[model samples]
Target: MMFASIASVALERAQMTRALLLRMIQMAEMRDPEETGPHVNRVGSYSIEIFEKWGMKHGLSEEEIDKKRDILRMAAMLHDVGKVAVSDKILKKRGQLTEEEYETMKRHTVRGARLFLDKASDFGEMVSEMNHYHSDFDAMAAQVALNHHEKWNGRGYPGHVDIATGSPLKDYAVPDYPHKALGKKEEEIPLVGRIVALADVYDALSTKRSYKEAWDEAKVLDLIGKEAGSHFDPELVEIFFSCLPVLRSIQQRYKEPEMPSE
Candidate 1:
């Protein structure tokens, strides 16, 4: 094959990656109006900013930090992509989810992870070889999607299950969720997943939702501070606060466009 043909394939591969993320986001927005493009963009931005600082504190090299941060920016945006499979009734509900609905809702984490898991590894050489980090990218993205909902205290949903088959990866089942694997806690949750988890919730709390008003920064900080080792990764939480100004800049950069006056 001509060298030009090979280069064209590489370009197509990159475009394919972008297309996958954007298309999935579009589908999800159709189901849940709140998962807007801008919301995902802010979450991605927050994740990388906080993760970079955490990496520096932990002694990761600069190159390693950027690589992980770049992958994380794209992956974190898809953290809620699985909501595409949920019913409009559940996703659009303005009130509390019923017990069964909540169980169904919890499946989004695993389902989102499933979107990028096993199938991604089977890409034919024509596409697979186009990007050197193809396998690792998919794996990291899958893990982010899978575990972003997990808590530091192991109370997170759809935890520790095989992404491919939804079977328990381990025997850890919670009393409230006997049918599925329990979510991971603290060290068990991968740092990558932990980073996005913190980023996603920060955005959710600070951003206005159908049932809630946008909270001021002080209120957001209080709740996050109180949940340090229970809800969020404690150290990441510290890094987040340390770089509060930067995170606010990102939040402003992606703020929603105002509606036109009537």
Candidate 2:
């Protein structure tokens, strides 16, 4: 009876954690049509596929992959959760944004990161103890949220910020960059960050959004290939094409729900 009871509680906790991911996605979807549940789901799915391949190539054990996958899945879904705080005009704008508007949109990274800091307490110690990661879920969720936009060439926003303040860690700030956080290049970007960076761009290109229609597979593949070492980490870019079959499966599995004929 005790074993059954413990299993039941564990299941409930798992459901609640998923519920939280849905709730946050719903909030962002309300503001930006492009930030749909399907989009986040796809990003999360792509992130894991990329991560799994990277882990294997780097010789990480199955146990390490399993544990990190759990956190990476949840964190990838919340990567854009900070968009909840961005102005609707920016997110919903149907056309190109002016420089000022673009800067405002970039703040979402730090804003999303700020949401996760110190949030583990709300989920309780049991959640942490069960996971057994060195840092709590909040830390990784915050990292992905802050680093997804970062480029392998070191031009991503919200780089090196004070996690608590969301203020640019000015010590490393680039000269005259309005948003202040310095670009995180190469290994300076976190692993999860690099994984999601590729995942996010893939989804953005593969899906139809307010800004543009989805690119065909060949075009999309070509662009990602060209971006290797510049926009994306070269190693991850290689891992991505290697697991192309699985990643393609995830894209279809989580593709956007179709609209009814008007």
Candidate 3:
């Protein structure tokens, strides 16, 4: 009887934990229904599709592919959960933010990662993966998170540090801090992050954001493709564009309803 009771308690905790995860995901969605809607869900799905395609092309084992796909999906869902920590004024701002506000906005990645850490056990390894994956860090997942913002010529954010010299590739105004540390593993960027980088940018551009008009699918793809090696990983750009037809289908199917204005 004691054994059975313990098992029952464990099951209940598991259920409650699952419920909370779903609720939090929804809360994140509600935070900006107009902008978010089914956007994240589609991004998650797109990430999975890209992984599957790559895995098939490379002939990965069934189990290995499935495991990695699951990780990508979970990581993708929590990708923007950090935005939850940002103030609505910033998140829902009408126009471009001042440099100060932009800095505050960037902190969402750190804040969002911390939120997941609080519930790490429930998400298992995914909690750690998503947090670091989206940032410009030296960690393995940084390819998907941190370095995704990095340009091939080294004109991105966090440091605008060039990927080659570890400094900015171009000159505008700020000093280029080229000697900063390269990511954790300079050898292999998480394929998932490379994939998500494209998907996330595509989703943001395609969605009708509060501040800007949604770009058509073709336009978004063209811009991303053009930025290949500049704003995004070049190899992934070809892979990403190839999947556009399917991605558009996803957008059509899961189009999020606009939130009612109060």
Give the range where candidate 3 is weakest over 10 consecutive residues by summed lDDT: 132-141
- After superposition, which runs of candidate 3 have C-alpha atoms over 4 Å from their true positions? 1-16, 33-35, 118-153, 159-189, 258-262
lDDT (Cα, tens digit) per residue for candidate 3, span 140-248: 2333444344344444443433332334335522535333323322124346656776778888898877677899867987898798876677766777777778877
Clashes of each: 0, 0, 13
Tens digit of per-residue lDDT, candidate 1, span 1-262: 6999988977888888777667777777777889988899998999899888988888999999877776788888888988888899999999899999998898888888877764554433333555766666778888888889889999886677877777777566656766678678888998888988888889999988888989998999999999999999899999989998998898889998776799
Cα RMSD of all models vs. native, in order, equals: 2.6, 2.7, 6.7
Q: Which candidate should be chosen as best, given TM-score against the real structure?
A: 1
State model 3's lDDT.
0.62
lDDT of each: 0.83, 0.83, 0.62
Models sorted by TM-score, best on top: 1, 2, 3
Local lDDT at 100 for model 3 = 83
